[model samples]
Target: MLIDAHCHLDFPDFDADREAVIERARAAGVAQFIVPGTTRRRWPAVLSLGARDDVSVCLGLHPYFMEEHAEGDIEALAQALEANPQSVAVGECGIDARFGDTLDAQWRLFDAQLRIAKARKLPVVVHCVRANDPVAKRLRQLDLPAGGLVHAFAGSPEQAGKFLDLGFVVGLGGAVTFDRAKRLQRAVQSLPDDGYVLETDSPDMPLAGHQGERNEPARVAEVCRVVAGLRGQGSEAVAANSTATARRLFRL
Candidate 1:
């Protein structure tokens, strides 16, 4: 009963055989997926896939793809969420300091989406890169009603605690499986049990040995296994707790 909590099955990467990809994940014990929308243009495809019983949808503007966002996309997102109450969360949104030029723009956009989530009483699925401090600061200030997920989190134990204190869960994925990710691995090992969630961010963050290849939800089981080993807990127990944490976070 594993859940891949941050996959992007809506992207064209799976257009040729989306159903088959899902079947493979099912075979690998992944029973559900949380597909977060990166931009408004991809919302229809995301909504289409989320219609399935096994998928949950989240809509937002990704900070990395700031260029793809339109002037009124935030308003459009609000309308979309209003029209689709079934949409569980308001994200795939957050700041990424990596993009120097769009730093200020990303903050504005991320804050706007956070406001929508706060108003709508829905959770969020955040994508952050090199900006945990500001993200935590803003979240503490905004205090969204439904706490969000810090998807694919790769930060220090202290940083993980900061986000958790601000009512967000840290998402650990394939990065934890790499030997070189000693800092991230240590953070995973020491972070409080209730402060974390499992995610794949599939079709993107591939596992250590599978670099340069297309990642899929099926590999989340492997993620669960590695994380369990790091925490010195049984894989089943780790999976159960993380799955429950996800269900709690997204109300899935």
Candidate 2:
């Protein structure tokens, strides 16, 4: 079974046909979906979606929408975590230097979530963009017992190695489908057996040739196939390995 270790199926893009979308994923060999919240307000919806047998949830503040997060948002996230003990992880949280306005605020928000995750011994589904060093630094400082994932990783070998050293796995998403993404493809190919997991980040990060279209968990099958091709193995082998890695990390 394949696990989409990161996605946003709770987002409005799937509101109309969410059930059918899930069925399609199941048909495509995607057995589990990790729907992570992008903000505190969306946690309810995320939790609602996660109520299904095949879905799990991760809640945190995404840096791209800084203005929407208020002062007590982190507290709200912590409460959400407490309220939904079944939630698999603590993120959708991390630094995104390329977007958003406040670097300081992003760090503070991410730091608060990390503290909660670390204290509760929960794994995080981190969202990092153009800020791997600072993100790695913070994770090292937290020294989380459960460790976490660096979702949609687009970095060099040295950077990916840093996250791996911190007990984190890289999430290969729709981005790896592009022929131009040779750097990311190489990283996926070179990672150790347990060093990577697969994600869709659905409704975003659409795969190559899927630009301007909606992405879905079902497409993770293609992602798994691409990774298998890169690693010179069969798709089922990559699926099993990545799914096992996700189950271990998210405790699914």
Candidate 3:
């Protein structure tokens, strides 16, 4: 069975038929799901999802929605994680250089979350985009004890190695299935057995042939197959290793 290590099932996109989506995923061999909070306001819903037997959660302020975050949200995150031991990690947090306007603010928020993850001894679920070098540098500086997962990673093999060195596993999803993604495919091939995990980033990163539609956790099985093909391994082995790596990283 596979574990979708990073997905946002709490988002409104799934509200209409959330149960059906999850059931489909389970039917497709996805045994578990990790939903990461993107903002303080959304933590309640994210935490609520975690109460399920198969769901785990993480809390943080996402870089994309800088305006949605407030001054004390970082403190609130720490408090919430303390209050809810069911939370497995501290993220959906990281730098996104796409929004150059808030680069510094993003770094500050990412830094605070990393500190919280360090002190709490929980892994992180990072959403890194176009800022891998700086993100790797910051992670090196803090040296989080529990490590983390770099969600939706599209970096080169060298960059993947850097994150692996820092006790983090790069998340591989729909992007690697495309023929044009030679770089990410190379990274996938070069990754050590435990150096990566499978994720859907549900309702966001739609797979290659399923473009223009909402992505869901069930497609992780296809992702597993694609990854297995890339690595010249069996689909079952890819699923098992990625699932084990996720469980080890998030303690799920």
Candidate 4:
């Protein structure tokens, strides 16, 4: 069975035919999906999807939507987790330096979530962009839980190593499909199979050949093919290894 370790199926992009999209993924051997919440407002949607047998959910605030987040959202997230023990992880949260000014707020939110995850003894699904150093630094400071996925990882092997040292899995996906993403491809290849997992980040970061198209969980198999090629392994091997890694990380 294959697992798309990180995705946002609760988003409107899948509203038209979400069930069909999931069926397509299952047909392609993508048997499971871990949907991470991007904001407090979306927590209900994410958890509702997770209520299904095939889906697992992670809850937290996303840095990109910093403006919409309230100061009490972190406390609310904690309460939500306490109310619903089914949540497998804490995130879709992290720092994004690309969007200036929100950097500080992002750090504050990220730290809060990290603390929550640590307290709950649950893994975190992190979203990072142009903030690997600081993210790494914070991970070092907090010493996160045993297992987590750094979703859509685009960092140097050295930085990847830092996360791995903290027992976090580096998530590889569509970004590696781009020929110009040499660094990301190298990171994908260099990742130890046990320390990495696959994701599609659906409805965003579509693979190379489908750049302008909407991505879905079904595309994860293609991502496996591309990543396997980069790692000099077969697609089946990539699927199996990533699935095992994800299962271990999320306790799915």
Best by lDDT: 3
- How accurate locally, in lDDT, is each candidate? 0.90, 0.89, 0.94, 0.89
Worst 10 residues of 4 by lDDT: 140-149
**lDDT per residue, candidate 2, 58-114, as tens digits?**
888898889889988877888888888998888888898986568888888888888
> Would you list the clashing residue pairs of candidate 4?
none
Instruction: Please rank every candidate by lDDT, starting with the best.
Output: 3, 1, 4, 2
TM-scores for all candidates: the values are 0.98, 0.97, 0.99, 0.98
How far in Å is the alpha carbon of 147 misplaced in model 4?
Answer: 3.5
Candidate 1 Cα outliers beyond 4 Å, as residue runs: none
Compared with the true structure, the alpha-carbon lDDT of candidate 3 equals 0.94
Poorest stretch of ten by lDDT in candidate 1: 191-200
Candidate 3 lDDT over 9-72, as tens digits, reads 9999999999999999999999999999999999999989988999999888899999999988
Residue 159 accuracy (lDDT) in model 2: 85
What is model 4's C-alpha RMSD?
A: 0.9
Which residue pairs show backbone clashes in model 1? none
- Comparing candidate 2 with candidate 4, which one achieves the higher TM-score? 4
Best by TM-score: 3
Residues 77-165 of candidate 1 have per-residue lDDT tens digits of 99999999889899899988989999989989999999999999998888889988888998999998889999999999889888888
Q: How many residue pairs collide in each prediction?
A: 0, 0, 0, 0
